[model samples]
Target: MSRDEQLRRAAYEEMEKHKDVVEKDPYRLHYHLMPTVGLLNDPNGFIQFKGTYHVYYQWMPFKTGHGAKFWGHYSSNDFVNWTHEEIALTPSEWYEKNGCYSGSAIEHDGKIYAYYTGNVKDEEGNRETYQCLAISEESLHFDKRGPVVHLPDGFTAHFRDPKVWEQDGAFFMVVGAQTRELKGAVALFRSDDLENWDYQGVLTGGGEGRLADFGYMFECPDLFPLGERDILIFSPQGIEASGMKYQNVYQAGYVAGQFDSATGTFEHGEFEELDRGFDFYAPQTTLDDKGRRILFAWMSVPDQNEQDHPTIEHKWLHTMTLPRELKLVDGKVRQVPLEEMEDLRVGPAIQVNVELNRETRVLKAVKGKAFEMEITDLSMTEGWFDLTVGDGIRFVYSSGEQTVTLERKSYVNGVVEKRQCSVKQLNSLRVFVDTSSIEVFVNEGEETFTARFYPSPNNDTVRFETSHQAVFTIRKWDLKHVNLK
Candidate 1:
């Protein structure tokens, strides 16, 4: 066997050893693609081909940790059930010696094309990136087309993660890149035959007047049309903490704007973060047949020094969040859980109107760690309102004079970690509570909080008692059994 085949075989063998723990129980994913084992990062090549949704991911098969990259495949008919496929692109080719990084997939005529980045390290430990392409005529067998577009002209080896889409009868691609001066930007390209690409100028960059600083570099840049405007999604590195922003080691988000293909520049407004939870990054979207824009994101930050994660002992480290429908609501993208999740609701349900701050406190059967609750503020109230849902888990939504602070308690041992931004409009709040997670969408995405929790099963009662009195409407739903096999 060839040396590349040896490496591919070694990686596959490692995945086999940790298969049990890696493919364990999946939680809270409504209708989206997820990993079966090990670590799943960037959402590579998402396409709907031959009446099936094919979603591939940046996979590391060696260990539960992020190792050499592999393109892991999955297919779904209704976005509900997924069938895992064999490894699509193995690192058994010289063009992709190190690994096959993140990219997008497309279907043309009858063939499915997978475009990705070939990442390699030279003898001197220098990184090399080749924009690679491959073809799968039958969706199972692949023929590597080798590197189609090499390092264009001015960028360094930091160039990677190509996202391709067809618009207005032509194909356009955007890739995350960095200048030789170490500035972060996205390079644009136009391709006709998927093999030949014409280089366009820098689409946009992160600088002083820019939305974000031109940090070390950007990765997994994705551009798509949303409503009347355009949305640019990417992961920016080296953003320092400035008060209430950039809390993670690396940030993945989007900029609302309009992309001008004529000048290759995107006139963008302030950057809006996609998620406020502990882990989310490298999101990619695909347009479905129904004309709805659906998106999926890696639920963990990249290159994090995760050592003692409980799941790591079992051999998997990450998962993807539920598939959310993306809509541009008032200049910001509003992500709502898909309607298909409603099918998971079984048994009798209950709704309540809780008068906050009263000793009326806990609602009877209205308690669960895994359920949905929508709270609408009838009047603007002051002080803090605590919604305790069994055990020590708390949903602290404080309308502190100016803004609302949404925090999750008893997560990871009483951390009381705060995700999502505060809602200034203290009029109402819509929340969804699951057995082990909480998702708060304030005023339809003006602000949102998605969190994971671990509370005992017996402690499933939800209590609502505020520090001050505030009239409210709470609607609850008892979810059906989730078959996470």
Candidate 2:
């Protein structure tokens, strides 16, 4: 076998040896994409080819830390069910001896061309990043074409994660970079063919003009047009927590406004976090065949208490968030689970339109590892109300404060932790609960908080209580598993 084939074989062997142990973890999400053995990070190379949707992610098969990463592949005919595919790219090439870092993919002339950053570290521990490509006809086998775009001047070697897209007959790439001054920036590149590339200029961010001194480095910069406006989605490092936002070690948000293709310039509004959650980072989107922009994000944060996750003890860690459909409402991005989730519904769900007073109400059919809940007509939820899921997670909303908070016991310690977001109203709340994670879409995706929490296994009871008189309707579902094999 070739070196890449040998390396891929070894990684798969390692994962198979520990698959049973990892699968036994109670925190293993029932419906989400998770690492079979080691660690999973940024969702990369999300593209709908032919009729199948493929999602690749940064994965290390040996351990939970950020070791040398391979592009782990998963494919889905529909958005709900997925099948794990062969390891797409291995880090055996000299250009990517250290790791095959994050990038994008495109299908041209029936050939799927994968563009990614080949990460290398010299003996002195210095970093050398190469924007490389690998082409495949079957999408499973790849022939490496090294370094289409090399390191440019004016930036640090931290330049990586090339998100490429085709626009107006030419391919454009946006590389997340850190300037020599250590400010975050996105470098724009243009190419007629997939191999040769021409460097444009910085699109935005950095200590340039109005955005003087943004984050230290921006990772996974994706630029795409949304309706009348353009959206620039990226994960920026070194942003401090402001109130209830940016609490994670890093933040993945978007700047939606206008972009000039000729000049490679973008005039964007303020950056907004895509998901207000305990764990969300490095989100990527791809337009489906039906022209819907679908997203999948790493449901775990990096560096911030990575070892705290109890799943690592079982020889695996991390997952991809539920595939969400993206919508632009009032110039802001709105994300909700794809409607195909309804197809996963199995048993009869609870439907109740009742008034909730100060007492707690425990709905018998409103709880499961895989389920959906719709809560609406909350115009009179005057004070704090708690929607408790089992023993751990609690969705608390204070209409008096116009804020929603998700509080749960920390995985490492039992200490209570919270992630809060401000909302103007509490007209509705749609929740999707999968084994260990919960995604809350408030007021039709106006605000959201996604999180991973470890409730006691088999304790599937959902309870809700109000501090005062609150009238709401609740529709709940018992969902079936989307088998990932």
Candidate 3:
């Protein structure tokens, strides 16, 4: 048998061995995508081809930890229902022996062409990187086209994650890279026929004065146009915490700018973080047939409390965040949950209009482990407003300070930790609560906070507390588990 076939068979065997344990975990998300077994990270190869939405993720089927990665595939006709397909790429080829790392997908001439990073390491722990290609005629089976672009000069093997797009009838690719000086950068390249690539200069970073002293390495660089501005989203490592921002171990953010294809220059604005949360990283975006920009991110950060996750005992580790539709509003990116997510609402929504004044109220109907809640038409002429869901997960809005804070018990230690973001007004909040996670969209996606919390399984309580007067209309729906075949 071929080595690829052998590896695929082994992965399937591993899934069979641990499927029961993984399924029994109380924390398994109902409406989110997660590995059947083992570890999953970095949403990859996200695209819509021939009217079908395809999402591939970095998967390691043997254990609930990082290792040689494979591309795990899923497809959906509408964004609501998903079908988990067979593994797309395994780490069986020589160049990608270490792993088939993260990348993006594009549809050209009725075929799906995927570009990814081939990660390889020598015996001495040295690294080698290649920009590889895999083409699918029918979007189900991919045939490897091997490496189309090799490591260029002046870069270390820390380079990977090629995000490709078609601009003006030519294909342009942006790769996350680290210079020999060990500075993070995004290198640009051009290809005429999807194979032969010409190296363009650094589109951003690489110690250029364009950006301040940034991180040491950048990974998963995705560049696309939203509205009239081009958006470049990337994950940068080694950014220290500045106030309430960059508090995560790594940062996933974007800079809105204009890209000059001929000059290979990206005139951009300052970096703005995409999500202000503990467990968001490696985000990838795709433009659908409807011309809407959509994104999916790995809900867990790499090397950030991975071992401490309670789900590790059940042999599965991570999940994908709810797919968000991206919009550029007032010169910044706004992420709103996809309209199709409304299809997950199962029963009649419980609606309430309440006013609070220096008191706490628990709405018995607004409680569930897996549900969606929206508090709209909010008028907070109060000192502070707090919403506590389940056990120790709290969302507090300080109208006096014009800030919103999300507090949850730390997984490593039981102490409650908080992540805060500034807001001008406490207008609206849309919260999605799953078995083990909470995602908050504030003010129509003006800001967002996503984190995983392991509340007591029986603690299905939703409480509202306020220091002074606060009024809002709350509507909630219990979201059903997605149909995954």
lDDT of 3 by residue, 1-485 (tens): 99999999999999999988888898998989999888999999999988889999999998888878999999998877899999999999999999999999999889989999999999999999999999999877899999999999999999999999998878999999999999999999998999999999888999995664798999999999999899999999999999998998999999999998877789999999999888899999999878889999999888888999999999999999999999999899999999998999998989999989889999988999899999989887759999999886999999889899999999889899988999989788999999999999999899999999998889999999999998899999999987577
Q: Which model, 2 or 3, shows the larger lDDT? A: 3
- CA lDDT of each candidate? 0.72, 0.87, 0.92
User: In terms of TM-score, which candidate is strongest?
Assistant: 3
List where candidate 3 sits over 4 angstroms from the true fold.
none
Q: Candidate 1 lDDT (Cα, whole model)?
A: 0.72
Clash count list over all predictions: 10, 1, 0
Q: Write the per-residue lDDT of candidate 2 for residues 1-485, one digit (tens) a residue.
A: 98887888899899889988887887887788988889999998999888899999999988888967899999988767889998999899899999999999989999889999999998898999999999988788888989999988899999999998898878899999999999999999999987899999888876885455668999999888777889999999998888887888899889998888777778888889998888888999999889898888998788878898888889988888888888998899999888777777777768888678788998776778778899987657468787998787999889789888999998888999999899877888889898888889988888878888888997989998898988888888877776688
Q: Provide the lDDT at 408 for model 2.
A: 90
**Model 1 over residues 264-314: C-alpha lDDT tens digits?**
678888777787765678888988888888887776777654544455666
- Give, for candidate 3, the lowest lDDT window spanning 10 residues: 204-213
TM-score ranking from best to worst? Answer: 3, 2, 1
Off by over 4 Å in 1: 1-16, 19-34, 206-212, 358-364, 367-370, 377-380, 388-393, 406-414, 426-437, 453-461, 478-485
Please name the candidate that would achieve the greatest lDDT relative to the true structure: 3
Off by over 4 Å in 2: none
Preferred candidate (TM-score higher): 2 or 3: 3
